[model samples]
Target: MTKDEFIQELEVLIRARYGVILINTLEEERALDLLTDLARKLNKRLLTWSCTRGLVMDGNTAVHPDTVDLMTAIAKAEQLAEEPSLFVWLDLQSHLNSSPVYIRRFKELAQEIRERMPSNSIIVGPLMEIPTELQKEVTIIDMPYPDLNELKMIISQFAQQYRDRNDLQIDCSESALDALGRASIGLSKTEIENCLAKSLVQHKRITGEDIDFILEEKKQNIRKSGILEYVDTEKLETADIGGLDNLKKWLEIRKKAYTPEAEQFGIGWPKGVLLVGVPGCGKSLSAKCVAASWKMPLLRLDLGRVFGMYVGSSEANIRLALSMSEAVSPSILWIDEIEKALSGLASSNQSDGGTTSRVFGTILTWMQEKKSPVFVFATANNIGSLPPELLRKGRFDEIFFVDLPNEQERAEIFRIHIKRIGRNPENFDIAKMVKLSGEASLGDGVRLTGSEIEACVNQALLEAFFVRNSEGHPEGDVTSADIERAIVQSVPLSRVRKEDIGYMRTWATDNAVRASLAPESALSSAPESPAMAEVTVGRNIDF
Candidate 1:
């Protein structure tokens, strides 16, 4: 929640004489500043306690220099018979949970405040450890990260600080400033301020270029969280990915759904898609592409690390991971090979005593009820292992079944990989390599996946780097013959796993959407194998 909204609610609760208020936050100074203003507006005495400071009134007047322990502080607070007062207890979570005597004293203090007293007890610390008996008496407030409006305020205040300095120049468009605020979403307010200040000291200028510096700050912040991984920035546009033309169209429309115009048109975010099909068909690559194309932070949720060694730790880890994802909104959470994470669901009750089931349930509920703009980009190769509940309606926007690339897509893939290495595609016979990649050209019945096709170009580069001419120098440039040798020697996974691909095609026919458009001419001339599977996609075009 915004600071204004939080202060408003706190004021209302204080006037109504609530007993105990628990604030779960890391921003102690920010919370205290708001509370100080609230106490002034209500004309109530504000008291604060710490182990070293004992009991202090309104800033620093000591109630008792001897009252420093937890029990003594409670007793001292109880003695202060002031009407309409507030006691903010700092650094108490670690001390109170140990002793039953301390717990009983807190319960009595809460009761005294509710029954006859006119004051309230406020506990500010990490995720609350309130005693089970005091659950109903305490109310929790989890402070939310700053929103875009608050971020803009911070940016304005930052720019104001350097208004007198002629050396500092600020250049930012309205849209770029908005983007900068969104990029700085998950960082603490202090981190954001420090980043903006550091940019001025380094370059004496603020522009759209400051975004990279802010993003670098975010990388450090995410690393400290220890739950979500901040994926390295590898930017890829739609043009970089080859063949998934139908998927590309769908993504292009989804990108527009996040704009302000779409909000005005009453359109919510399009739920993310689940890419399930053949291995190495660019499913994981699509996740990275979306993060780069949309300019959103990419976080990978590794399931292996989430399942902790302790009994209840796995469930807690999943919740923490999901919470962190929401904190970084308008971001992509890439869960690669998701089915493997849930593969033990059926036997969860028997093996780990429902730990796996509980973890899976947490994710299922989060996806359905989450209001955050965290797009879950999940990919999998084993569709059979996935539970039917995950494939149900409204769980994901859609499930696209990726298949092996056709002849034309192979040519496109070859062109992309070759050009990426600074080699001219025109200099090589790409048509021959495309034909050789499929079963139509060779009797081996192998259709290389996107990764396998890239491997062919890499293999050619390695061979050319080693071959020496008569002058004892490296050949330095790859040839069409070099790539041809790599293709002839490599065996694609499609050839070895024919039955698995056929089974996946059968499953897709009943339950999933097609990722690529299949041309009828190509399907007709294909051999009697998984390559000839008759797939019918949406009628964006007629065959």
Candidate 2:
């Protein structure tokens, strides 16, 4: 929520005489500033306290320093029968729940303050720790991070501060300021200040380039959260991924879904797609491509990390992660290997005390009701582990089954990997490798995944890299012979998990959209494709 909206709400609550308000926030200094302003507007005295400061007046002038103890502060607050007033306890939650006596005293003080003259007490801290006894008396308010307008205000102020400086310049345009505001959504005021200063120092001017520095700052937030990973999408391109033509086409159609023109055309933001099928078949890579292709930040949600040990902690962590994603709208949330996170869903009630069920339910509900531009790209290899509710209609906009690459896709994959490593795809005879392998009869090469093909290419390159010619110099180019040997040495997942792959194909045939549109000629001639053979998997693809 914006600072103004928060102040309006606080005004309403204070007017209605809410006994105590607990604000959960990381921005303690910003929250205190808002409270002080609110106090002045409402004609109330503002008193601030800390374990060390001991109940100071507005946190500057001390009042009875002997009352440094929390219990004494609570007692003094209860006795304060002055005009309408607000007492803010800064970081009190750090030690508020450690002792039963402190919790009881807090409850008593809250009840007493409610009966006294117009006065309110607020506990401001990052952690939310309200004892059951005081849950009824204390109201919790989650202080949202700075919104776009506030961020813009911060930027304007920052630029204004350097208006007199002769060495530095502010080269920000109006549009650039808007973009910076959008990029700085999830950052705190202090973080924005520090980042703006860093940007000026690094480039000697604040311009569009600072957005990259701001993104780097956000990476620190992701690292600190430990649940969501900041995926670097700068190097990823839709062209880097081979095949999944259907999926690529779908993504391209909606590439402008978040644009203003689309909004004017009355198109709602695209929800997202769920990719489920054989492992190493480009499901996860597509997630990265979606973000890079559409120009959005990529956040990888590790559900396993969201499950916390404390009671109610798991739910809170998921809430925080979702909120963080929403804050950075027009972004992509990539949940890789989602099925593994929900592995215990079948017996969640008996196992983990229903924590898994709760977390899954939270995600399901969010996916259905969320209006944010945060598109979710979830990939799963173990389809059976996924609950029916997740597969039901409307949960995800579409579910695409990423089957193994066909012969044509395998060739494309080989070309992409080979080209990426500075080698021309035409340098090697990919077709000869396909025909000579001789194991091309099983399901028309339905087993060749893009990853395995890349592996084959890599193996061939390694052979060429180390092998010495008769002249003793390193071989300059990879050959069909080298590729054939690599393909022979490797075994694709299709043959090893043949039964599982067949089951998946059967399920996907009726239940999901196909990600590939393999050419009939390639499928017919190769039959099972070179991937069926043990001899030529080609270049290695690393995620």
Against the true structure, whose lDDT is highest? Answer: 1
Which ranges in model 2 have alpha carbons more than 4 Å from their true place? 434-446, 469-476, 519-543
| Predicted candidate 2 versus true structure: per-residue lDDT over 1-543, tens digit per residue | 667777788788788778888888889889988988889888888888888888888658887987688888888877773567798988676566688888888777777777766888888886575677777998877787888888988888888778777888785568878978888988899998899999788877777668987888888887788889989888889998888777788788878787889999999988888898889878888988878888888999999899988989999899889988987777899999999999999898998999999999999999999988889899988788889999988888788888777666777777788798887878778776654333453344335577777787888877687775644776357777887787777777877887787677677766788787655565456456444332122222121
Error of 1 at 80 (Å): 2.5
Which TM-score value belongs to model 1? Answer: 0.92
In order, what lDDT does every prediction score?
0.82, 0.79
TM-scores of all predicted structures: 0.92, 0.92
What local lDDT does model 2 show for residue 440? 53
